[model samples]
Target: MTTQTYTPNEEKRVYAGTTMLMIGSCIGASLLALGNRFSNLGWPLSTVYMTLAVIFSFWGYRQIIDACTYTRYSTIRSLLIVTWNKVIAEIVGYATMFLIFGFLVAYCVISSDYIHSIYNFFSKTPACNQPAAYDEGLCNEYIKCVAASNKVDKIIRAIVGGGAFMLLSFVSSVGILSLISSLSLILVVFSISVILGRCIEALIKGKLAHDSGGWTRREPPIPYKPDVWSVLIDFPSYFSLYTLIPTIPSLYAEMKGSISEKTKIIHRTSIYATVVLITIYMLLAYVTSATFYGSNQENYRQDNILNNFSDNDKLVLSVRILYVLVIFTAFVCCLFPCRAILLDIVKADRTTKRGKVLFFVTGIIIVLLLTILAIFVPSITLVFDIITSLFGFVLYLGLPILVGLKIPVLKARREYMEATRAAMHRKDPDTEMKQTNAMEAKIRDRTNSITAFLSVFGPGATERVRQASESIVRRMSMTSDRLSIGGRADRASSSSGRRLSSYRHSHIPFKGVPSTIPEASDLSKIETPPLNNVSLESEHARQQSRLQTIPETYEHDRNRVQEVTEPDTEEEETTHNISTRVVTEQVAIDHSHTISDEVLLEGFTPPKVSLKRQIILWTITSLFIITNSTSFVMTIIKIFSPKGNTGVCPK
Candidate 1:
């Protein structure tokens, strides 16, 4: 059978594309519920929460940037595998998968529900015809009108949810996420402009600030007295606001540029997106709350703020349409990262037919599951609450910081190895040997330090540290001995059948002399003046005898060289440090084959970092993990508490 050739899946992504992806995913269906929730917090408090959330989000986003810079891993699973062990990585990886799935289901549910709401709002005629009658009787009748279409609404939701995912699958297969993101960005800007325009119009018409005060008589910028309840209610919304942070690594990986350039792109795009999102959310929340700020304002609260506005208003109707487009585009944008992570987990080559089949199979199953969930579980509040509180904490807040701590430790080791290796390339064998001895001492000290620091993590950590240290030490010792200048000189002498240097061969006594010989290591302690004081005839006789023994010594070296040239057993290589041994053997081969010095120094293993640096990194890592874990537990407890806020705005 003939084999089919497939094209590579490489696609170019630009700065605008990256920016649009961030904004598109950030402004998902969750924003529909934001106005109501922010209204509950009022102007000052919500502004504070959003500000703090942005700061933390940016901090976490920076960690991912740094991680991608060093590791160049495209997916979260890949980064996790390097920063932690495979077992922990897989555990966290699967959890992140579920998190993304939850988000996918949430987007579907919110989008479908909002579409139904929009339809219900416009399709039915109001019971009260007059403007004054709207508040007196029509408002209540509107709820009844909406409920009357429940059966039709469910059918509409199912069709929309399923059709949207089907469209996403088709679009993804065709590789149009870039096109989708661009469109989503346009929708995002238009939607924001429309909301702000309406807000500005309300302000111009003097419909916002009441005679009671700017925000109401008692609380100027807040509706209710700021309490513990408000904080808990707003916390999850804060996490939801910056939900795009977790997907940044995948996006960073896809961008076509050097690591530095990608970092710059991410930084610039993130700043712009943050400014736009924050300005819009804060301004919209302030204006929305200002319009209806009072004890009676709670009466107007909606899961979707559009419900509070007049259905007949052209601006509001257009906003609904804009949101519908935004939701679908955003849905497609979110799917790309999910696909990337899933493919990474399965270790599938996307260019192959089997891999493509697996991807479609997985995608269909996920979409079908999400569609069923959207049809049945219609509450967006419940979905966002659980997701932002739990997965949000782990993925966005916890993992990034955890990875950041290990980065510096690895970086220090790398820099140290490079500097030491460069220092060892000196022309003077004595100087190079001296530096090599110093490096050994330093390595031992660092190993001890690393072991002590790791011991704090408990015995499992300590044992791993010990093994790594022993393996690294053994490999370094072999490498240093084999690759050092003195070692190179010795190898050259043996291979060329030349007499050894005096400093190395002084331990061998002259064949005719009966005097004691100095050890090579103790050559410095021997008195050279005694040799000078001997007679010229005796010296000539000693030199002639030493030359006579050269053939035997060369023959012995030939045999030794033959033995050293033999290939090592695979099992023996495996027993040592694999990476170190491979690199060392490569260098040995390079030397034997007369490869350049630069090529020989290329694959040296990084030495352990100083103990102080390890302490600092581990300390910071523990701090971040502890803080995130504690906050996560507390949030979870509050979420499940009997009296906890369901993140629903008060009616």
Candidate 2:
């Protein structure tokens, strides 16, 4: 009961393995079942649509990948939730679930045919000795002979196949699904090789009917079409090659490396898959149509293309086995997304043991339920057709493409950048200036302090505040230098000993470069007095003569004595001046630095893609929806009608 883990060696290769997984998923039921419908597109147009499908699917799926990887949404459901509303998220999420489930159910439902066909071919009987073309009819007759047997063996075998599918899916690890799909990819390639080989053999042997034998023989028809509108209507089915989309995101998540690396995987996948698909499809279409399009048997074209193979054809038997193996393996792995989506909806944590058990049980239940429906329903062709179109194309392909067009990633990027720039460049003439003024006033008010007490300690401040405080100290230092008041009192006394002589003795004197503080009364006559020293002799003499005019009489100089108490006792003044300078110089510098507000921005926001490009994508997406939805409606209509496939002939 031990679990198996994949070693590094068991891991799928990032490039070719991813490509195989996709082709295995996409190349099932559609190719064999819808051969005639695609054959009607004509060989040349078929080639065109094949090329276009590869191009557009890669383009659209690339957008899906870009949205997830670039926007970081990561999953299709998450992408929908972010790009669309919550309601649309639920709608699409559930729709994706239904489509994947339908694919599994459809495969199981059709497994009955493969089983019945094989049983008929292998079972021994006199009637079974006939050509394999009549094996189905002959085998049914033998069932009646076996004492009321109604193909019981065939039903039981088909049920066993379905059960085995469920069993393999449950035991499988996530890596095992990749392994199974990769192996299935090999089966698919081999199957196509057989079909292509048979077609070539038929052509070389002249067994393939052609009009080169004259009007009596069939030849491949004209490359062009007579009705463009009808051809366009059926055009969406070209994407029958890309019926599933959830896997793109799922595969992309598992892929290791950069987006460019992952994209190279997708490019190789789409190109190689398209080439393989169209080559097989074209050969089948040309050989089949050239043989049977106008024949009376055209109306009875079987749902499976290989059923149309002649009883004598050796390749039909092998192709049937390959197609069955394709369906069974695809059914097993195709249900992976369904279980994963349900887990997502329920918010299950797969990392826990309980969550792992829950996921396993859910996978089993999904497979069993699908198997039961397939067993009971007998046929769900019409239902499969409708669900595939409505859910697969409309919901997965059409809506996502439209959303990519509508959401405007380019526009969102521009808007986010523009808003960011505007927010960064935002000037605050109100708050910034207010803070600057508050800081300046705080510095100025502190400068006006007249404390004479010893002061050296103050509150610590941020670096910006400390810088402002330091500038205040420099300003006070400049004022003190002019007054010769602080520790520089001895220099001032030495200067006053020859005060006017000191003023006149300057060798480097420039105009208005004053070295002394002017009295308030004299500051009035010179309205805006300069801070530099006064170098002009006449102006200096006037200020000097005014200073000398002070009276020595007590009555006349009463205010002058109080204002000019220049160190009444030299020791007392020296101590007070030392305390004042020490207090002013005491400052704390913070360690942190502030980032500047200025930004150097360049270039304007790039505008959205032109209206013309948008309209073209818009129109193309609309046509896809309309055509595919209409096709879904027709499938529903087919359920009530008992007509066989009315295969179209070349025009």
Candidate 3:
């Protein structure tokens, strides 16, 4: 698709799209499903889980953003490929695609259900012909009407709706994407306000009952206490709330900012977006639970929370229509990334005929598969839990940590080598030197903190940290040749061509070899002195002095040497001097460009690490592993559990 490309430091007229998109993405049909999921766990437990997720997710997001600051790769897949091996990158990349696909399928299913809800709400029923509050008998009659409608006809409608959504997303231009993204943000805020208003209104009217810390009935007095088992089982469903993490990287790429300030911009925007999300979720959960959760109304916990409200309520009907718009735009938003991943994996150039065929064929297959799942499988929570729990951990936590660890090692080598190479060439190495020093200092501080923290856990922990850091440096060294060779060639070609040609014609200083042969010493034995501490100005002065003496040395040679019996001896000596200079220059050029094994090892070594930071990192890592494993197990249980959805709709 055609798109606008901005220069790195360009200014924009509005708030960054990353912030708006993050907010919009977080507020979708998922909100409709969350009320029911939270009801299963009491509000207290749900709040705790959500709070924990936000905290950890923010921490993990920060790590990924920091890693992005070091590279120019816009796609997470490309970043992963560079940070890790291609195999691991491919696996995680495809897994991320699957995650997005699952969410899209869930959206399709919910949209279809909402459409039916709207149609049934508007159609006249025999049980109660007039507008009134929701009644079991009346709802049952409406349900029966929907059930009795042509199954084939309903399926056809679902297919048409889903297919159209997929097609619209597939063909959308960059401008269209941007427009919908902006609109989705506005719609999200509006919908949340309306929903929140209705819930608060119910509370104000005393329609919602609250007793002590628990939601209870007057006659039964049964308290809702969520057990740990229930929390663990339902955790994935709620944790899926932060499934927006992977998409943030791409949004950061699109945001306008200078290279130095991009990370800060995205991080600040993320904080704001997250606060908005937390406020919306917590308010909706608190108000909705107090209003519709527990008591004899437990059956009112429908997948689509709005289904609990009376279909006759004009406000709820408007919300439903508004939600449909949100879903339509959100579906397209998600489709863009999923489609991008698919194209990337197949290595398709969308502008080509072969690529066009593959794009349509894959797009059709994806739409059809998801449409089938949305139609046949009825539970949005289960699908969400399974997909999000498994892949969310990988994208949100696992890969970010792995990628973060590798970045310092790669960065250290690149910056250090750049500085060292500049120093050898007598260029102004000040900028590169400062950057190298800063990187090293940063790595040193991090390492020291890690080692210091780990010391409390005994020497074994500290040793492991040391070993891991060394191993990373070693692995990076192995890859340095490829980077260094290409980098040097590019710098060489881009350097001043006229200067290089002049240097070749005239005797000029080169590293590791003398500019001319000395009569008193052999070329191999004449050692090249170290110039590591040499300043740029001093080197320039020395070169100019050497140039001035060149003509005088020629005059001295001509005057001092007597004419031999052979007349052409002077010509022979001049020819020999020219050949010797050229040979020495070639040798110097070769030696200057080649990086030895000894230099590579010394320059690419990691900074010294301490114990404290090691302990902190280990603690966080252990927690991550525990959470991922728990979620994976929970996802399995969620998938196999016979407990089906019990709600107003068929699902």
- TM-score of every prediction relative to native: 0.57, 0.55, 0.62
lDDT of 1 by residue, 268-314 (tens): 88887787778767776666665553444433445555555555566
Whole-model Cα lDDT of every candidate shown, in order: 0.57, 0.54, 0.60
Model 3 vs. true fold: TM: 0.62
Worst 10-residue lDDT window for candidate 1 reads 209-218
Using TM-score as the measure, name the better of candidate 1 and candidate 3.
Answer: 3
Tens-place lDDT per residue, model 3, 173-231, is 55665675567667666766766776776657645222112222322222256746457
Q: Model 2 scores what on Cα lDDT?
A: 0.54
lDDT of 3: 0.60
lDDT of 2 by residue, 566-639 (tens): 55553345433533333333221111122221321234443466688688887887777787777766655555
Candidate 1 steric clashes:
0
Output the number of the TM-score-best candidate: 3
Local error of candidate 1 at residue 599 (angstroms): 10
Order of the predicted models by TM-score, top scorer first: 3, 1, 2
